[model samples]
Target: MARMPSAERRRQLTEAAIRAMTRDGVPRTTTRSIAAEAGVSLSVFHYCFDSKQELLESVMTTITEHYVAVVRDAIRPRATVRETIRAGLQAYWDHVAAHPGEHMLTYELTQYALRQPGFGHLARRQYELYAEIYEALIEQLAAGMELDPSVKVPVLARYLAAMTDGLTLNFLVAGDAGAAADILDVIADHVADLFRADT
Candidate 1:
C-alpha cells in the first residue's frame, strides 16, 4: 500500500513544482529536477503525480486557478466599479513584478496550446476564465450600456482582459514594469470611459 501524503507535504510539492516549471519552462522541467527542487525523490514525484503529463496539466491548472482567484479578489464589491478595476489591474502588476518568469511558463503554455489540440483546450479554458472575470467587472459597473446589444458587455470585457494580458507580457519582455505601471491608470480610465459611455 502507498503512504498517504500529509497536507503540508502535498502543498510543498505542488508549490515546488510550480516554481520549477515557471523558472525553467516546460522543455527543461523534468521530474528529476522538480524532485530535486522540492527536496524529494523521484518516487515522491511518481506518488504525487502518475506521469509527467499529469503533473504538467495539474501545474498549469494550479497556476491558472491561482491567478484567476487573485484577479477576482482584486476588487471588493463595495468599492466603486472604477476603483475595483484599478485595484484588480494593480494586483496583476504587483503579481507580474514579483513573478516575471512565472508568467513566461504561461506564455509558453499558450504557445504550446495554440499548436497542440490537447493543450489548446487549456488555452481556451484560460481565455474563458479571463472573459468571465471581465464580465463580472463589467456587469458590476455597466448598466444600460450603449454598445451593440449583442456584444456590449462581452466585448468590453474581452478588450480589457486582452489589453491587460498584453501589457503584462510587454512589461515582462522589456523588463520595465515601472514604465508599464505609468500607463496602466490611463488605460484603465480609457476602458472605463469606453464602456461607461452609455451607462
Candidate 2:
C-alpha cells in the first residue's frame, strides 16, 4: 500500500483500533489486530501510538468529535424551540442508527477504561466532553430563540447528556425506533417548556 501522511496514518490507526475493539471486544483487542485492520504492520502501530492506552484515548477523542459534529450538523435555527429540539434529537437518533457498531464500541471502551488501571479518568473526561458539547448547543439554541433557560446551562447540559445516554442504551437493546421517537418527543416538549422565555 502507498504510504500515508503521519496525521492520516494516526487517524487510520485510531479508526482501526475502534473497529478492532468493536469486533473483538477490549479483552481480545491487540496492537497486532489493530495494525492488521489498518492494513499496516505492527511497527507502524508502534510508530503511531506509543501504547494501546494511548491509541484508545485517541479513539475516544475521535469518536467524541464525530458524534458532536453529527448532532451539531443536525441542529438548525428553527422558528420554535420545540422544532429545534425535535430536529436535534432526531438527528442524534439517526446518527445512532447509522453507526451502531461504533456507538457500541464507545460504550464498551468506556467500561474498559473505567475498569483498567490509570484509565478511569478517561471515562470521566468522556462525560465532561459530552457535557461541554451539550452545554454549548443549549446555549446556542437559547440565543437563537432569544430566550433564557429556567435552569443553569451546566445543570441542563448534564441532565441532557445523562438522558441521552440512557435513551440510547434503551433504544440499542430494544431495537425500538418507534418507542425512542416517542421518548424524544417527550424530551422535546420538556425542553421547549423548560427553556422558553418567561411569559
Candidate 3:
C-alpha cells in the first residue's frame, strides 16, 4: 500500500516511465522499477497505468504525438511541397537520432505486434496515417509534373519512407548522424528526379 498521488504527480510518473522504457527497454521496464525511478510508490504506478501494456501504449502515443506535432508546427504556408518535406525529414532524422533507445523500443513493440493481431491492427492504422502524410507531401512536391500512372502514389510514398527508414537503421547501427544526413540528401535528389520524370 502507498499514499495517493496528485494528478501532477501521476503525469510525472508517466513521463518517468517513458524515460525508463527508453533507457531499459520493454522487458526491463517493470512498474516497480518505474515507481522507484520516479520516486513514487508502487500504488502511484498502478493508479496511473492499469498495466504495463497500457503504459507502453501511452508512451507510444506520446512519442508519436510529439513527432507529428513537431512536423505540423514546422510546416510553412509559403513553402513548396519539397521544402515542407525536407523540413519534415530533417525533423524526423533529428528526433530519431536523439532517441535511439525509444526507437528500439518502438521496433520491439512492432515485432511483438507481429504476433498479436489486434496490436498489428493498431500498427497498420498508424502506418496508414504516416503513409498518407508522406503521400500528400509527394503529391504536392510533384504537382506540376506528370507521373507514370503505373507508379502508384502510394508506392512512391512507401519508397520514400523506406529510404528514410533505411537511413535511420544505418544510423542506429553505425551511430553516424552525419551519414544519415548524407543519405537523406541522396534520397531527396532521387525524389526530385522521380518528380521530374515524364509521364
- Quick one: best lDDT, which candidate? 2
- On a 0 to 100 scale, what is the lDDT of residue 178 in model 2? 91
Per-residue lDDT over 1-199 for candidate 3, one digit per residue giving the tens place of the 0 to 100 score: 3555566666677678778877887677788988998897797678777755566566666666656666655544334445555676777777887777766766666666566645665566555666776787666555566665667899888887667667766777899888778777777556655544344
Give each model a TM-score: 0.75, 0.92, 0.70
Clash-forming residue pairs, model 3: none
Quote the positional error of residue 156 for candidate 1 in Å: 2.9
> Candidate 2 lDDT, tens digit per residue, 1-199?
7889988999999888888887888889888988999999999889988876788889888987877887787677777889888898888888888888888887998999999999998888888988999998887777645445357889889988988899988877989989989999999988887765534
**Which stretches of candidate 2 lie above 4 Å from their native place?**
146-149, 197-199
* CA error at residue 79 for candidate 1, angstroms: 6.3
Task: Tell me how candidate 2 scores on lDDT.
Answer: 0.84
Against the unseen true structure, what C-alpha lDDT does each candidate score?
0.71, 0.84, 0.68
TM-score of model 3 vs. true structure: 0.70
Q: Report the lDDT tens digits of candidate 1 across residue range 4-112.
A: 5655555666678889878877777788888899888788777777755566566666676666667667765434455656777887777877777777777887776
